[model samples]
Every structure is written in C-alpha cells, then in structure tokens.
Target: MINLTGKVAVVTGASRGIGKTIAKKLHQAGADVVLVARNRELLEKNAADLGAAMVVSMDVSSADEVQAGFKEIIREKGNIDILVNNAGITRDNLLLRLKEEDIQQVLDVNLKSMFFTSKSVLKPMMKQRHGRIINITSVIGLMGNSGQSNYAASKAGIIGFTKSLAREIGSRNITVNAIAPGFIETEMTAELPETVQKEMAESIALGRFGSTEDVANAVLFLASDLAGYITGEVMNVTGGMYM
Candidate 1:
C-alpha cells in the first residue's frame, strides 16, 4: 500500500466536488489535511466528515486572505508538505461577448491564486526542502473549447506556471505538476444539458466521463513518495479525451 503517513496537505476548493474527494483520499492515505474554501458551512461540514486536520475559509483571489491563512498553517503546523491549487471559476462566453470582469475573475481564481498560494507556501517548504504542489487544470486548456475562452486561458496559464516553478524549485526537492481533467462526472458536469454531455461522451476515447476518483487518484500519485523524482509534467486524467 502507498504510505503517506505524516504528510501535511492543504487543498483549496475543499468545500465540494473534486476538492472534497481529494481531501478524503489524502486523509485516507494518512495525511493531515487543511481544507480551504469560501464557504464556511461547507468547509466545516467537510472538515468534520473528512476529519480535516484544520480548516481555513479564504477567498483564493484575495492576497491578504491567502497570506494570512498560510501563515496560520505555518504557525500551527510549521510546514505544508503538499499544496493543491484547485479553486477555480468559469464564466463562459464567446470571445466577442466576454466581459472584462469575467475574464479577470477566471484568471484570478484559476491562475493568479496559484501564484499567491504557491508563493506563501514555498518559504516553509524550502526550509524543509521538500514539497508537492499540484494545480488542477482542464483538457480544454490544452485542446481549447468554444465558449470557455477565459477558462482555457487560465488553465493553460497554470501549465506554464507549473513548468516554470518546477525549474526554479527542483533543487529544493519541490515537485510541481498540473492535472488536466477531461470531462469528469461532477456537479459541474451534471449542470450541463443532457445533449451537451452526450456529445462530450462521444468524443472521449474511453467512451465515458471520468469520475472524481479518477482525478483524485492521479493527484495522490503525484503527491506521494512515488512521484518524488517527477516534476513539471502535465498529467492528463481525461479518459483519453485529448490523447
């Protein structure tokens, strides 16, 4: 069995969906997790259910909140062994009709938040000289999509950021990687119309949508000791959607 005993991980967007499952799987792997999100009630519920080692309600877009929250974690736990930047938003619109605010919001949460959170945690991780940072992106970021211009751009940005950071911190034993999920079965996918979902399924070589667990397992692999030598690679957990 893969042993993750004694690891300390912080998963942003832990209030629900893939974040919730990632939190659970990491806990089961023996890591003490810190759950962060904007929803206090949902965070609390997840914290209780997952036995999260700690909980921090912070807006990923706000630098001050991310700084303070990471401070609290460092003050209390001394360091974070794994950091997952999973909080993101999508404001789908045609390029011509897209609003400036929509573009900024998507970039802030999907891209800029990783910059801030990764910065805040790096000091402590460098001190310990060991860390794992995973950014959740999308296959659309690689292949592009019609209406998700903002999302695609932000996710693609994460891939570039991950690669760059990996080079900067590889000497310190820090591994940075991005996971681009294909069409996964989540509340987000469930929200799509049946016709859209069917069309998407047809495109996947796997002939179906991936589950939250599919993505979570890939994340666990990257965060665990098994991936210590791996860094800066983008793993596609997309049920063969892009391959």
Candidate 2:
C-alpha cells in the first residue's frame, strides 16, 4: 500500500473534476494537501471537504502569481514534497478557425503554467533531496486530435518538459513525470452526446470511459514512495485508447 503521511502536496487546478479528485486522493493518503485554483469559492469548498491545509486562488499561468503563491505555500507549509501540475484549459478549434486569443490562452494555461509551478518548487525539493512532479498531459498530445491543435501542442510540450526536467533533477532525487489520460468520464465528457460518448468509448480497449478515480489512483502511485525510482516517463491512463 502507498502512503504519503507528512508529505505536503500542492495540486493546481484542483477546484473540480480531475484536479479535485487528485487532491482528494492525496489528502486521503495523509498528505497535507494545498489546493490551487482561480475559483476561490469552489476551492474553499473542496479544502473544507478534504481538510486541506491551504488554498491559493490564483491564475497559475501568470508567472508572478505562481511564484508568489508557491512562496506563500512554502512559507506556511514548510516545504513542498509533491507538485501536481494538473491545471489545464482547452480551446478547441481547427487550425484555420482558431482565434489568436484562444491559441494563446490555451498555451498559457495548459503549457506555461507547468513551467511556472515546476520552477517554483525546485529549490525546496532540491534542498530536501526529494520531490515528485506530475504533469497531467493527454492522449491528444501523443495522438493528434481534430479541432484541437492548440490543446495538443500544449499537452505535447508538457511531455517534453517532463522528460527534460526529470533528467535535470534526477541527481537531486526529484522525479518529474507526466500522466496522459484519454476519455475519462468527467463533468466535461459527460456533457457530450450519447452517440459521441459511445463512439469514443468503443475506441478504447477497455470498452468504457475511465472514472476520475482511475486517474487519481495513478497520481497517488506516482506521488508515493512506491514510485520513488520512476521518473521522466509518461504513464497512460487511456485504457489502450491510443495504442
């Protein structure tokens, strides 16, 4: 069994859906969880529900906010043992039809936020000689998707970032990795038409959409000591959807 007692875990974009579930799992594993999101109200509710130690309402894509937010977290929590970069936004459109603003927003939120958050936690993790950085990427990153060029590019960038950072900090005992999930049954996916959902599920080898618990369980494993030796890899929670 994996245990994370006494660890300080920071989960960004943790107000709802996959992010919230990840935070809940980490909290259940005995980590002193800190939830981050732009939605303060929702964040506060989750913090209360999970008894999280901290909640930072900030736009993670903004470098200044992220730096200040992490500084506050480190100051209050003492140190960060785990950082989950699960905060992402989708602006889906064909290349020709995509707006300039939409492209920029997706890149900033989905891709750039990881750079900010990851950089913020490195010092404390390095000093302690241990850390786990998990980036939530997607299968569209590996298998390109129609009408989602911007989103795909952002997720793919995260994969590269994960590998490079893992290699950079492995000597310091800080492990960086990415999880790519496909067709998970979240609030967003549930809104899709029944035909669309069926079609998507049929493509997966598992023949069903995964639950939030499925992705959260992966985060739990990666964050635990059980995965101490694992780093710089992309673990797919896609049920063989892209293979």
Candidate 3:
C-alpha cells in the first residue's frame, strides 16, 4: 500500500533468490529499481524483465569495486533512496575443519560487502536526508548453526554493523535495519539433503520453509515510509524459528 513512486532503490545480489524477489517487489511498489550482481547475463536478464531499470555488475566484496560501481549509479540516477545489502555467500564447515580461505571469503562477501556497499550509499543518502538501508542477515547469526561458523560470524557481524550505522545516521533521516531470514527455500537450500530440509521445516513454527516472497514482503515494508520511525532494529522474517 506504500507508494514509492519516483524513488530510487538498489538491491545487491539481485540476480537470484531473495535479492531478485526484493528487486521485483520494490519495482512493483513504484521505485526505480537497480539490480546489482556479479553475473552480467543474469543481471541483464533481470533488468530487462524489470523494464530496464539499471544493472551494475561487480563483486561487492571488493571495496574499490563497490565504490566505483556506486559512483556510476549515482552519476546516472542522481540519488539513492533505498539500499538493500543482500549480496552474501555461505562457506559452511565446522570450526576445526574450516579452511582459512573459507573464513575470509565468507566474511568478505557477507560482512565486508555490507560495509562497502553501505558506506558507498551513505554520501548520497545523507545528502538527500532520506533513505532506507535494509541488510539481509540470517537466523543463524542470532543463534548458531553447527557447521556454518563462518557464515554465522559474518551475519552476526552484520547485525552489529546495522545497529551502529543506524545510530550514526538516524539523525539524517536515514534508517538502517537488518532482516534475519530463517529457513528460506532457495537454490542453496534445494541442494540440501531431503532429510535436512524436512528437519529445518519441522523446526519452523510455520511448518514450512519460507519463500523468497516472504522475505521480499518484509523488505518492502521496511523500505517504505511506514517504517520511517523504525531504525537500529533487526526484523526477523524467521517464521518464529527463534524468538
């Protein structure tokens, strides 16, 4: 019901999964949506499907690439009203067995990318004095998962980063928040063993894994004016998996 007409929104990792759904949802709400992802072909296809809003192809883990990519977006779009830090990767393994590269790669893509992308948008958001920053964290970050130490650490780091940034920029009317999704059915989860998926579904109060649309709806709400008064908060789209 919230109208975002004339607003500009950016979603990273928008080529697939929750990111892609969020982009479409925002576009449906009348925001000019820009899709950011490393896959140019997918990004182009999504952009075309979304009416050619815009597409920025770059690895968000690199600070320089994020900086340069945002610069280009701002140059063309003039301002950014909403930013969804949804680009993330999961490198899962037990602590003792996890490789050093696994830890670093997970942190870089999941946590550091948020740092880079959020910082990149601050200037434009502050200048405009109105913005929404929605970070896609995870339920694993809140509690913990047995085999995903690195991913859990990165997502937890995002919660801290979201809170700190919200406090720092709240005065400017820019709200920063994080959304922690529980067991969402995506390509990644589809690869999990059937038994594991059933176990995950049984753990959720909703009795099923969430769909990408569920998470996208939450993002749409946070990105809308309805959530203007909400900041420095973590909204769990977890179907009561954790309270």
lDDT of 3 by residue, 1-243 (tens): 978999999999999999999999999999999999999899999988988779999999999999999999999999999999999988777899999999999999999999899989999999989999999999999998999999999999999999999999999999999999999988877877798788888888878789999999999999998999999899999898988
TM-score per candidate: 0.98, 0.97, 0.98
Per-residue lDDT, model 3, residue 100, is: 97
Candidate 1: worst-modelled 10 consecutive residues by lDDT: 46-55
lDDT, model 3 = 0.93
Candidate 2 lDDT over 56-83, as tens digits, reads 9999999999999999999998999999
Backbone-clash count (model 1): 0
- Lowest summed lDDT across 10 adjacent residues in model 2 is found at 184-193
Off by over 4 Å in 1: none
Select the stronger candidate by TM-score from 2 and 3.
3
Candidate 1 residue-wise lDDT, 123-157, digit = tens: 98999999999999999999999999999999999
Model 1 TM: 0.98
Model 3 spans > 4 angstroms off = none
